[model samples]
Target: RLAARSGLSVGRLKISVVTTAKYLIPSLLGEFCQAYPNIEPEFQIGNRAEIIQRLKQNLDDLYVFSNPPRELDITTDFLTKNPLVVIAKQGHPLKDKKSILWEELYGERLLMRENGSGTRYAIEAFFKENRIKMQNPITIASNEAIKESVMAGLGIAIISQHALNHMAPGNLIELPVHGFPIPNSWYWVLPKGKHVSNAAMAFREHVTQGLSHKKPNEHA
Candidate 1:
């Protein structure tokens, strides 16, 4: 084990990340792997609760979360901003509206992530602080599914801006709702006092350098 931690080119890297981080982490991991060809990366993707369970068990060398679990004794590093935005299918009536009020969403069908989702938690907190109650929300388990549903014109959803990176140009449009693009960020987490593997450390350094080169808007 000690020998493994001392070498970066030939060891396994176990990384667990939340479902939302799926959009960003894989590409980063791909870059890291390309640079260190022999390093094996075990990437586990799950929703917030599942990832938290893995964190509690200390199951991986690293973990990623948009909203880190508050009760755990873990150390975290900011990876990138994960802004949540409101999106609706193209041609929707509200697409052209400017500075749409939060109240305007009250009548529209809202698509939500399942309970225990970091995005849902953030959105719920925002709604509570604003005294807004979702009239009737459709709970979906994955970000991809929610995006598909939104594109199908089922309803509008609040999702990470990164999720929009690979989307087609006109399938969906971001809503001009006030207080939108809720400010959030992805973090790299590890149990407090945990041993840092060399491969994991290398990946961290790679992410830092990679993100530094990105323009501000490109972060989303």
Candidate 2:
């Protein structure tokens, strides 16, 4: 709860965040809501391009982007380093292996996010750089759909570890991809020269301090 003595907006803080749909749905948003009921957050999950576009339009007080561009006209702060992981159905052929190679995934029926999605871009780049051949993926728009596809043994995918918690037991398995992880940092950005609202600033400080005090395991 916001301190009554603060006399801040204390009722609403419209935070616009751009991160993974997986994180927004069940992890980051949930924790934030539980901690600050007065703060109302609106999220738009998309690729770096979409997030940057929204920032340029002054549509959001804050944006949570992965790998935000250095040349953007915005102020930035680090949130967390998210590592990518490969996901597959349980009892998959590669499950018993300690790790799998990028080449090992060649010819696999991969599930992929739609174009313009940050997750899809990263996965595609990784495969291309390593010359790993993948079959035409069944493209989906949201993380939820992707998760459901993987759970049904439709195809495997590389996604943020945040989604692992929500996977159905004995239905989805995390595949260890070689040369994987491809660590990405979550960042908060604000438009240049624009002063932040009092409520937004309060929530920002709360989140910044909260992140600083977090145990490694909590973020990990």
Candidate 3:
């Protein structure tokens, strides 16, 4: 409270976020820093499992992810949409189609993220809902790597739209999967009952104010 009341001398925060939000979250943090120029901010970028470990140790003021894990005793505020989309190399047979059925995807060799990735979970959940079984999927290391494999014509994959930054000119294209653009949102999560710092509290308010009206989950 003294640091916040002092209003410019000392404010610091620690934050950990999942990998896919690397580009967007940093920009938001930069905006927050402009108001508290001296705020010492620390960041860790990792996958979902790494983030869960960090949260267990209470490492950061906030944790961010697309799919919220229920195991954590945290309070989450929806920040923004993290829509998922299917992508394939340019000139793939489905490129010109506007709305391809999900069942149609079964015919194509699919590229997938590593076993523990959030994208993989999202993909699995979608398949499970429709009782669709995924055959052997080419396992890539990261979203960027998946894009690379797709560009090489390995197969198509679903990923957060933000990671589309990894695409090179005309190398890959978005395929219109019916009932796709999965309606998921990024959330700012803080463990309840933990000691919240003024800087951390301020940052929470900074983000929450913009999203107070959004529902916790998105739907079709």
Candidate 4:
């Protein structure tokens, strides 16, 4: 009953989506827009710094990201927990292995995200903490590009499992690694102590319901 009434109003709501272009650019945003056709979604695809700056300037109504700052004057809600996985070509020698160790990646050519990318930061931190020596053979900015490069046999990379659905058939293979599996949280942030617009609130509820309705028996 509420779902049909939520997005009917044409209140102009401005949303600033922060995060990688992989998830938001088409998938999430496309569905969100379909639910609330009147509300406009603006995206600022960059590192965390850009999103923080936008929030500081009151330029955004909401922030969609993997992580939000601890001290920001924002209300937050947990959205999803995404796990990190290593990826290579399907026929790559590593695919046959049950599991790979951090040390096993040493000297392997890697296609990596640039500095300031959250995924790259998390993976690098994991490697540093475990004292793993990894080779950075190439660096790119977008997940799509990195996935394509890895599929082309340019190098292997660590990426979110959620993004694997977008990769090619028998092209990029996700490798299960022992002592690895970087889990990260995705969140929604809104201004603290301020009333969120009806349109924005509706969008939030729509997304929440959508996620909540995902059945265990269904394929993602």
Predicted structure with the largest lDDT when compared to the true one: 1
User: Model 2, 104-179: lDDT tens per residue?
Assistant: 8776778777877777777777778877776778888777788888888788887776655544455787887777
Itemize residue pairs with steric clashes in candidate 3. Answer: none
Question: How many steric overlaps are in each model, in order?
Answer: 0, 0, 0, 0
Candidate 1, residues 1-220: lDDT per residue as tens digits? 0112334657788999998887766766667777788898899998899999999998999999989987889998888899999999888887777899878878778999999899999998888888876667999988888889998988899998888665545698888889887899999999999998878888888777777766776677
Sort by TM-score, best first. 1, 3, 4, 2
TM-score versus the correct structure, for each prediction: 0.92, 0.80, 0.84, 0.83
Which candidate would rank higher by lDDT, 1 or 2?
Answer: 1
CA displacement after TM-score superposition, residue 105 of candidate 2 (Å): 1.3
lDDT of 3 by residue, 141-220 (tens): 68888888888888888888778643345688888988887777788877778877778777766665434433444111
- What ranges in model 2 sit over 4 Å off? 1-7, 10-12, 19-40, 45-49, 128-135, 167-170, 209-218
| Regions of model 3 farther than 4 Å from truth | 1-11, 165-168, 205-220
* Clashing residue pairs in candidate 2 (N, C-alpha, C atoms within 3 angstroms): none
Best by TM-score: 1
- lDDT (C-alpha) at residue 158 in model 1: 93
Evaluated against the true structure, the overall lDDT of model 4 is 0.69
Model 4 residue 82 distance off true place after TM-score fit, in angstroms: 1.9
State in Å the error of residue 129, model 4: 3.6
Q: After superposition, how far is residue 218 of candidate 3 from its true place, in Å?
A: 18
Could you give the candidate ranking by lDDT, starting with the highest?
1, 3, 4, 2
